[model samples]
Target: MNAFLKFMKRNYKIVALVVLLAGALFGFTMIPGQKENDPDKDKLLIELLTYVIEKGHYNPAAIDDTFSKGVYKDYLENIDPSKRFFTQADINEFSKYETQLDDQINNRDLSFFYLTYGRLQQRIKEANSFYKDILAKPFDFKADESFNTDYEKMPFAKDDAELRDRWRKQLKLSVLSSVADKEKMQDAPAEDKLKDKEKGFSDEKALEAKPGADVNKTKANGEKKSFTELEKEARESTLKSLNDYFDFVGDLKQEEWFSIYMNAIAERFDPHTYYFAPDDKDKFDTSMRGSLEGIGARLQKKNDFVEISELIPGGPAWRGKELEQGDLIMKVAQGKDQPVDISGMRLDDVVKKIKGPKGTEVRLTVKKVDGSVKTIAITREVVEIEETYAKSSIVKKGGKTYGVIYLPKFYIDFENQDNRDAAKDVAAEVDHLKAQGVDGIVMDLRDNGGGSLKTVVDIAGLFIEKGPVVQVRSRAEDGKPSDKPEVLTDNDPKVHYDGPLVVLINNFSASASEIFAAAIQDYNRGLILGSKQSYGKGTVQNIIDLNRFVRGSTFGNLGALKTTTQKFYRINGGSTQREGVKSDIIMPDKYSYIEIGERDSDNALPWDKIAQAPYKPFKNNFAPAIANSKKRIAESAEFKLMDENAKFLSERKDDNNYSLNIDKFKADAAKIEVAAKKFKALGKYNSNLTFDALPYEKEKFKNDPALAEKKKDWYESLGKDAYVNEALNVLDDLQPKGGKTASTEAKKETRIKTR
Candidate 1:
């Protein structure tokens, strides 16, 4: 049976949505009971349901049914807000289940509820059994033969069961080691050793080699201590270290175990999504808001050590030039001069040491890439979103300059009193580019995950005169439906730019990016070009404060729930959910192995259509312009090399298994190395520089060459990066000239069809 259905069947009674209206009518308005059926639950649930139905994976027809069932299933499986601190009697009450919960749910029988309650009781009984098992076991290392350095790596103990056994043995060994250490310390004759040292017998070698004192060969009671005996002592020392680690973990309480379980479940959803306890919510919110007062760098714990991953451009670290990606941070000091070594420390504890109030200084001692050590001081400050804002550069091609704006992400500072948003930044860029007499502008939204919905609509409005950008449909309580496009809300009548424009996107472009691209395509305002499609995350989420759902309490529930709320659609009637915006000119990308864009995600909103908003097309007679652009792109040597690299990667991905023979691996590695060398040569030519020979250092070449080749191919692939060349060619075609209109019109049509 499906996991969700099975859970629902067992706990239908407890999991059932008790209508808030019903609870209010019953006059159950006291603490726990009143809070359990508060109006906020219904409101939040409805809002989330509506959003999921409109923007979630299921078709509109299946959305309502799926969401209603799914939500109930979720509640049934995990809604035991009270920590399971049940008595022995509760465990006994839950042990009599005969049938699986699914059968009961499907049959709508009361037996299902009883069985579910019984199951919970049975789990508590199992917990008690586990406790007794631990208590009854002998806390001695000798009986547990698994106490060795290689215990964790042994093949016999591969699974969780074996690992647990190993942990138990290690714990016992740790206790024995501690006892031995105390015994050795107590027996130490401090006065005798001090007297011997004063008498010129201090050196361990000199004392052992004393005349008629062959200590190495001597044995107590005529028995020799062999080499094997010495080896055993060394092994015991290593095992003692392992035991110490296990002892610490084994001491956690049952409540901590439950918390760990909850955290693990949240991690299973996605890397970005997390389930935060009430205490962690504030920190989570602060991080997401991007206003944290700390040295602006993202770090990750790798191999039990923290390493810098990305430096937010213009942030403290970036400005100071003290930290770089791949640098290992060994220690962190907050205000105090004494530095604390963070090696092998928990990531949370390290973060606490680094993060502090604005204007406070933090010192980091990092190991640089060149084997040099450096101590750097950084002052924590509020990270400004403007530091990551969209900026444009003018690229001159064939004497014609074109504007290229790089938008990293659609960021919005919602908490700021003056919201200087992405849309505004982009508009300002467009104005700047237009004033420079640029022939055209290229809006690069590659790798942009998206941000505010309001910002997207505003950005889309800048290009189009005035029209609806997208449509949103939300679930209604009475099983009704509502839909409307998000139209341009820019009150200012002044236009930013009225020139040719092109949008560059890839698989990483999503949500707000999709909205903007779809709008431009619908209006035929400019060309959309890049990889196959964009990420199709079209649903919006509203954060519901659980405090509102708790009745008759000032503190209320301490957790907030983020629920899906609405689905966004393009004004042209098509939903950009599963069917993300498809570019006019497709490019090749290395991430083809990765299932990206909307349709790839499970449980994502499906594509649908609604009534199209009326809008006039931005007619441009630039057919010959595109054909001319394509011809240039096809002939570029840089593009050809990139295509070869992409083909190699695609071929590599298709091969399921690699040859196990060492010789075969080496040969393959060599061929890859040569290909990479060729790709680098191509880059050198593009920049008009002397190409250096391949760096064949064993460590560097082993993996670097393969990675370099992949990058080279990604850029060269036709559908992947034709935009850059196309943009350059497009600029050339748009140059004002005394040319024949008829020929230009024909060329434009041909290019459009081909693209």
Candidate 2:
């Protein structure tokens, strides 16, 4: 869900144009005290969103019947994908507005949204009662029954009776599966259970147990219960899960649902354009800022109570030392104000109540682990999310130390330029690795769904001399590409780590990640190793604050819109929109045989080419290293198993029919177990490499035990990674034998003039 964002401050022309369009298109009465759910507010949102997209979007879709139909289908599927809530009668009634939505949107009509929303609420209420009634009695496992999970191909129920039957079958299938798991654990011998534990298998009974579940009825007590007892316990767990799900759904406000309808209209143009409500806008800002002012504690809903899941280290809650992880929060109060009961309240609403500005106090009434009720007060402060920043580890392989820097995203705090960013953090990491006397480095970008464009340019500049990083072209008023593409370059000539280098990527690496990889590949600065290709997202979006367009209104925050403003291409002139950036050394992964990139989206833009920018390729020849990695991959048994697993999953993608009959279901499951046994060793494969934290981080562990534990788990996971091991092997091959590395003697290339 990440995107490449270009700050509006850096693009003045686009901002000016958007402001002019807003001034010309909007002229409405400003209601100073309008209610939040007023229809006029929804109309204003629709009008404002459409105008922005039409004026700022790179290639806006025509709002005609075809566009309306796409929105209609997407909106329906998004609301109820399983076809459980809505019957055929409901669909038939909603079909009248399928082609009228485009006209309605132009007129700022809310008729269709109201009709569908009202019907869905009624169906949800009916379905809730149906589940409770169905779970009240025991299911007939002896009877032959089956459930097909291919909801897309299934037809809607014709009447209320058929809908109830559908609900019954779904619940029966769920209970049957849980019962089968319980039966397996009870039937297994003690030695077999220990063997399973050694293989990293979890305790199925413990995992399936919900909060406040009966201890005597579950496998946790090591009791061998009858089939009837296990079935009853499974049913109880399912009921609790459903109740919790409905509770969360029941808390969603009307404005939140309206945001979905707004996005349905925006996404027809492209997949990246989206509409963010006020709360969602705040969340997006917090994510980009990597810090928030609040009592830093993770909470989870347990039945009707909220439990403290974790206390973020170095935050106010953790520093208090009075609150524990298992404490159940019963009431919350602001300073000396009266406590408000939070029972059955939504988790997000509880979080909103607990979080406050820095130096503010919030008191919590919590039930302690020992059943003692106590009131505790904590002062809020800024809590930085440590996981958002870049981290590195050093490992010694074949007598050479190599540093692996993992960048989760190209993050930057847009509101404050002085805050830490990906470019600054990455440069610091390079300096740390050099101080550690490492022979080579690996820039791990797998699953990094991009961020700022400026950070990518700066990060790419770490290895190469001054040159073009990427080329971007905007759509003009005539719906044609700009005459000349703007070439973004890194002007610095100094190389941070000029020695042997490798950049690792996978199917989830996108946007700015692709830009960095493409720059490295184009300059021949490093070998791109991992999946066949990265995620094919080449579009750039800018967040437009919607409040700026409104003159004077008490509608509160109008939120913001993220619209696609331009498309980016690689310096080689080829668009990475659909093709992404191909790896120099292709690696086998679990998703290798599946379609999961931007190309999988039907609304994605088409791939094209532009004039290539002039730049010099490094003299370093990676052919020998690439050839060696290919040879190793061909002979490795672990990779071969992964490839086989990928093919097995691809073949089973459409096999959604599941048997509800106990005997038949067990037989079907045994066949799958036998087939999946070959891939079990892939999980246990270990590289046997030793990865350690740098000296500075290790020193901090003396006072921070949580940080120590987190890094310990990270190092353990890295030691088991086969992909990281192979990347180290490639870096070993790239090491200079009798002279300096290839990049040391490379000459800089001159920048090409714009057309």
Candidate 3:
């Protein structure tokens, strides 16, 4: 049996007895009081409340403020008929409340529920009104364009006149859409006019093969095509494109329209969470499982254009080496054919056009960063990019080597049993590094958004002796703790390494990553170094089956609900809520310009504490190590240069407004170039004077080779890592012996000379 089951059996008997007595008293009142009741109202309230409570995973008492007791009971019956959380005996004891349900209803205060319900109802009504208006007089696409361009400001238009003016513009656009459709019908060829059939003429070829077409006046040396013929062909091609768009829109269903609206609202919440329709559920599952057949690129809409944001490192696109960041996708074709123009298209429509079954060919016409155009062909396939996985490299400095492991994200292949798990893989890496005889290790978890909870516990266990990893507390339903702290295991008692360790985290480090870092800090197992704090996300969500809460006889699928079920607290009782893990040493980052972490987010859960768990601390003192590191970094030329670059980036972020004039742009570019050169020169003068400037040239820098090299060096330096350098210095200070090594003495001399 599980620990939860054990707890329930041990304490539930007393709680059930108390609830039974209350139910009996409540039931007695139902017999005496007589008043007319709206049976439908009671039933409706119960249905809504029950579905929400069981699936919502909130406190049962919350229902009192949002619904009546009788309604609550109805919801309980529908939601938990099998009494998985509460036994049948407990339910029988509570049946007495059914008799006095009306009396308990009088005590209910559902203000919050009413408000939320009212808002939902209002949105539905507004949507209905818009639908009816559109049906009566369809949207005019042309006029809507003007208003849509400034639609963001419409919300703050101040007066009815301004709002009406904006609406008028929108109405005009709707009329234009209708006009465009009419024009398309008149211009389309007889066979191609049908929505199902494609136009016979290739868009590009049609422009060259029109009536009165002019043959080239000259050869490739100085060729010229007939302008009049080309113009006519272009017009015909554009009309066909419009016809295709109309046909696509006409096929959309009412549910699809609503989905588009709902998606807009969900997007406003965040980029990740989405409301998937039944048809999209399969793809959703695949994405979460980290397996999908596509071009292996993450795309997003920016400034009304679909742009490729990230090329999955070992995916088809990355392997092809043609697709790159800032490349504008103008069109997508299934094979070696004239591509359909996707410019000025909706993001979803573009996505639909690109996604297809595995082994299918997809061609992308791309506009490169250098104003060059090229067509890249890629065969869709499952992309497993190991670049995102934890990878280790050795950094040798002053005769000692440190293993530098970079964990970009806490990823796992839950769907593929044969795949290597992240925690297991990382452990193996640690073992390998240990065998290589490295003196210390630097686990870089920067920008890791975290993943599987089980994996996090396993990773933490690798650093500490076995003990309770984290405590989870679910809101009590009937005045008692719902579950106890689940103690995770590391089974293997052997320590991977007994050497010094340093964990590097940043503002982007979150969830399971934060948990691992916190565990290490709480146990004093390693040196924590990086930004001020990490992304604080301490809530746990579980997928609940909605079929259990249906009102009818047969189970109807309403989709699964991922609701927050519990709060996770550190074993020491502190919650990683608004306050994520704090670093022992801070590093300057360009992202510092933007507000990051849970404290910066609205509606973030507050930090709290529970109770401490027993655990032993790792015997390492790092204060002196950090102090000495600070002294070294303050005088290091490379460190100073990095700091200057960080400040410049921050300034550029703050002053983003730029002139479009060629002269002004050139001048600004020149200024930036000068600054970069000075920063590089400083690095050369201070440390590694023999380091060549050729490696840091503009052409090399453009490809980010310098940044990549620096990052690698930073990780390898271990105690010499500017941040880790400080950490090691602090450790030295905390130790009985202070900085006494030849390397330390040499660094001290360099610091004095630089100062």
Q: Evaluated with lDDT, which candidate comes out highest?
A: 2
- Give each model a TM-score: 0.55, 0.80, 0.55
lDDT of 1 by residue, 361-396 (tens): 777767543333345678898765445678665655
Write down the lDDT of every candidate, Cα atoms only: 0.50, 0.78, 0.50
Backbone clash pairs in model 2 (N, Cα, C under 3 Å; residues 3+ apart or in different chains), count: 0
Local accuracy of candidate 3 as per-residue lDDT tens digits, 1-755:
64434433433343333334434332321123322332333232334333333333423233332233434343343222212123334345445554444344333433323332333344333333443232343232222123232221223333434534443443333333222223333455556444312211111111111111111222265433343333333334334443453445445443333333233222222222233433445444544333234787766543334677556644667556567645667666664343565643555667776777888777776644333344567788776554556666654445555566767666676689678688887887787777666667778886576777667777777766666666667656454445555544445555555566778887767778888888888877777888778877776644433333333412122343344445667777788876888887666544444455567644345577877776655545566666666677668666666677666655543332222232343355456557656654532332221111222233544787744564343333333345544433343343333424322333345446658
Q: Which ten residues in a row have the lowest lDDT in candidate 3?
A: 205-214
- Residues forming the 10-long window of minimal summed lDDT in candidate 2: 203-212
What is model 1's C-alpha RMSD? 16.3
* TM-score of candidate 3 relative to the true fold: 0.55
Which tens-of-lDDT digit does each residue in 1-755 have in candidate 2?
Answer: 11123333335567568877787566444776769588988999999899888888887888999999989988887677668899999999999999999999999999999999999889989898788999999999989988876677899999999999988888888678767766776677778654532222221111111121221333557668899998888788778767766776687778877877888898888887888777667764553233245777767543345777555545667556567655777667676443455654555667788887898878776754433345567788886578557989999999899999989779898789999899999999999999999889999998677888879988999998888888888866565667676778888888888888899998878899999999999888899999999989999887898888877667878889888888899999999898899999999886788776788788888899998998877877789999999999999998888899888766655566777789998898788778878877887989999999999899999999988987787788789989999999999999886666656755422223222
Judged by lDDT against the true structure, how good is candidate 1? 0.50
Name the lDDT value of residue 95 in candidate 2: 97
